[model samples]
Target: MFREIPTVNRLLQKKWNDKDQQIHLQKLKNAKSTFNIKKRRSSSRRISKSTSKKDKIQEDRFKQIERDNKILLQKMRRIMKNHSGVNLPFEKGSLNKGMRKKQLADITLANYQLLQRLQDKKSNYNVLKWEKDRIDNKKLAQRIGIFSSTMVDPAHSKSKQALPTLKNPRESTTRMTKKRMKKNYQTELQPLEFPSSFPKRAKTTTRKRKRTIATPEEDGDKAKDLDLAKVCSIPEEREVIFQASKNDGKKYEVEISQTEDKMFIAAANKVKHSEHYLIELEKEKGEEILKEFNNNFQVILDNLKVISRRLVLLNPNINDPKRANTTRNRTRKKNFRKLNKRGNASQPSLRPGTVNSPSGDLMGVMPETARPVSPTQNTNDLQA
Candidate 1:
């Protein structure tokens, strides 16, 4: 048994020689062999302190990572909501280590890319509108003889100070989109309505056509009235009767002679026997042919039935792009084509000899008799 602290205190108070101190203070590898309790407990306490410090360091690092992640997510949400008017949530805690880092990096990259795209589109629209307004202003300036070339103002002042600077430069895209919650998704949706004073477009009507059948002329068919002799070079003779064979188109002639009548009678008797033999042969072969056809008739019927059943059972592809009958994909392609048409879209050309007012509404065209104001024109006459 190990002695208590009071025994160790009494031992320490007694002065001992160097060899006796060393023997008593010696440590052993085996726990049962060790006699000094304080030495063993002290060594264990040192090891425990090192392990605890390491665990504390690791725990602190994990907590720091968690805190930073929360802040990052908050900033991303704020940015998305401000720019796109959509508040999106990021998936957290579901990933760890490499997967977690990858998720956050992807989210940040996506956010920046989406932000850039939205801002660029908005800036591009603003730039196009600005260019259109500038062009319209130039045309108006030229019409009133206050163009940059003339360096004249509305008051017809010759001084440079009278003319407003035409260079209203545009701001950068970053500065433009820097505002938070700019879209402000609180506005109510409204249907568009044209003002009552707007002119109505002309309505086009389609005309329907009636189908009529043709009737024969009252003068009778033209083919029956025409003489065949006038159209063809072949001669029509009355001495010998001529008939054409329906099968071969060969012309047969009969002459009123005794030898010809005898030949015709003998030919008719031979033809009757040959015709009777041919009819009997056909009847003999017909039965064999019918038997052969009957063997495969059921098989042909079964194949037709199988094909019909497969067609009825097969499902039709509704949204497949490979199918030519897919109307959804076809309509999607049409919408893409419609969106592609925007490149050529521009504001309508200004009316000739006219200018838009300060309010952006187009002013009425000038009278034909009224000529353009020259640089030398008086200001009072223009005002009137």
Candidate 2:
């Protein structure tokens, strides 16, 4: 029995040995394949002697072509120098007059064609440059806030007058008056007066009052005395008294009297009459009707303001969120749904699923089912 158990163990060991041997054989075969691949790569990268010889031949041929080109260019330059006129170098000393004339005409025609080409190119370039300048000027005008017909064109600006002109009548009048004053002053000679030499005095006068004795009499007797005093005070008698004086000093008399005529009386009367007439006309026309309409309109505006204030007070939730929660919750739910929809639209599918999955499953094999039409595509289709 022990011998049979030992034979069974040997069989298991044999099976393990066969598996290990197969694994080692696979590793050795892989190593040999890799070595062969490296050898092939190295051999392919090596350059052949025949290719190097071919490269040298090609280089020599290119050099010869370059040298030939340079020699031809030098010969052409010499020929051009000898025949600088319209005549060709080959026909420079030819005795055939008709051939020379024909060559000269051909050269002139070629020159005219070249000149025309050059002129056309120049005109095209000028037109393009003018268009660019116009675009740049428009952009500059926009930046400078100048949007009106008065914006001057740079092309036509040269013909405009550059010097300043007198366009304002008031300014021109002031300049003319200043010139006239300067001319008048130039012809006149006057001595300048100094305030220190002639001191200024106040334009006011004072009078001496004559003393009168009060009479203790009745009102009628007082009135009679004043009349007699006034009759005795005569200007001629006073002048005679002054002339009879022995003193050589000058005598002056001042009189104070009230006059019925005034300089501003007529003007004051006319102004008062005009003001009274205007007041009467205004009353007769009932101009207060305009004031009544203005007052009523103002009252209506005030009432509207009051109603708006009351409405604002009643609906505080319009600005304040703490006043109500139902509206806030509704708005939050709407915004949340909108954000979820946008996220679903923007995210790509990373897992296998049906095309019509409610949660936005995008995996599918068919082209029409794999990709969904976006809002932008719909808008483009509509526009088209």
lDDT (Cα atoms) of all candidates against the true structure: 0.38, 0.38
Where does the lowest 10-residue lDDT sum fall in candidate 2? Answer: 262-271
Listed in order, each prediction's TM-score against the native is 0.14, 0.14
Task: Report the CA-based lDDT of candidate 1 relative to the real structure.
Answer: 0.38
lDDT tens readout by residue for model 2, 1-384: 123344558878778778999999999888744354442534434566667888999999999999999999998999888975667556355578889899999999999999998875623255656776787787777554333323345553233356755677665457888899778554332223323544456566577668653323334433223321133222222111011111112111112111222000000011111110000112212223224324342222121111211100112222235544765444544544564677753332222111211133322211212222344333233110
Query: What are the root-mean-square deviations of the candidates from the true structure over C-alphas?
Result: 45.2, 45.2
Over 4 Å off in model 2, which ranges?
1-96, 112-384
